[model samples]
Target: MGIHWKIKSFEALSTHELYDIMKLRSTIFVVEQNCVYLDLDGKDKVALHLYGEFEGKIVAYSRLFKPGISFENASIGRVVVDANYRERKWGHDLMREAIAGIKTHFGESKITIGAQLYLKKFYESHGFVQTSEMYLEDDIPHIEMKRESC
Candidate 1:
């Protein structure tokens, strides 16, 4: 068996599931990145959570947003793969699922994201184009990217 994918809204997430999501986000976004920002931005309530689970642990995760929620276009954020799982192609898998989920749930093909500068090419491979200059967010360099439906 391989990783399992799940897409759920805030209201549909169980307490443990929510906790696991938060834990993974913090592990990467806060500790690994060493950037301190409000992780709970009060937007998770409206976004769709996409994650991959393996062996009972959340390994890869991203959040999908409908238009007008996080950005004017459909968006995917908080993309992460457990550091140990990076070699397994889970990151690509997560983004593929996220793009599909965005289309499935929002009926939109235009998607945007605030991606870490280091991962620009990774996103570009998935059809995202850099739309903004390099900028600092919580002391880490980031770039805004957009993907339009082909």
Candidate 2:
């Protein structure tokens, strides 16, 4: 079966959905990865959230920003997919929809992302190219990448 997609702003999120989103982000970014970085950086209200829910759980998610908010250009961040759903290849699907939403809602032609270094190839497949040397954010290796509007 295919995943279901939901894109909404912080205000539009139901309490339960908001909880699930935070839980998933923490589960993967904090507990799973063992990274204690601050996840809530006062940016949610300005972002458009993208989630792929399956059976009432947020299996995949990302937060998209308009230009000059998170980066000098529009960007996508906090990309995550639940461990249980990894085998289903939902990450790619989630990102494709996120990029589409960026184009549709923001009319943005270019976007930047500070992606985990290991997933560089994955993001490149979607047209994002590395634009900077690798750096550590919260002790995890990351690189800046950008994709121009297609």
Candidate 3:
């Protein structure tokens, strides 16, 4: 089977959809990573949510932000693919959709992301260039990356 992609605003998300999103995020960013930080940073209300559903469950997801929210340029954050689904290369698919979503929804040419240091090469493959030195975000080593409009 193939994955289905969907993009929606916070207000447009159904309660079940929102719950699944939060569950997936917590499963990855919290339990899997062992990170202890505030997952609900109060940004969801304004950012766009992009997710990939497989077998009726969200297996991949990301959040899109317009300029001036998380960075000076449009941004993509919370990029994730379910643990069981990593082998399918859905991370790349999620990013492709995210970049397009930013351009289509925000009319922005450039995008920035605070990516985990270990995944620098993965994000670079999508044209995101490292823009900042590594820093600690949520106790994880991270660096800022930027992808300019083509």
Q: How does each model score on lDDT?
A: 0.94, 0.93, 0.96
Angstrom error at residue 95, model 1: 0.3
Candidate 2 vs candidate 3: the lDDT winner is 3
lDDT of 1 by residue, 1-150 (tens): 899999999999999999999999999999998888899999899989999999999999999999988789999999999999999989999999999999999899999899999999999999999999999988889999999982
Number of the top candidate by TM-score?
A: 3
Per-model TM-score versus the true fold: 0.97, 0.98, 0.98
> Which window of 10 residues has the lowest lDDT sum in candidate 1?
141-150
Candidate 1 residue runs with Cα over 4 Å from true position: none
Q: Write the per-residue lDDT of candidate 3 for residues 65-101, one digit (tens) a residue.
A: 9999999999999999999999999999999999999
Show model 2 residue runs off by greater than 4 Å: none
Candidate number with greatest lDDT: 3
Q: Is candidate 1 or candidate 3 better by TM-score?
A: 3
Query: Which ten contiguous residues of candidate 2 have the minimum total lDDT?
Result: 49-58
Clashing pairs in 1: none
Per-structure clash totals for the candidates: 0, 1, 0
Per-residue C-alpha lDDT of model 2 across residues 81-124, encoded as one tens digit per residue: 99998999899998899899999989997999999999999999
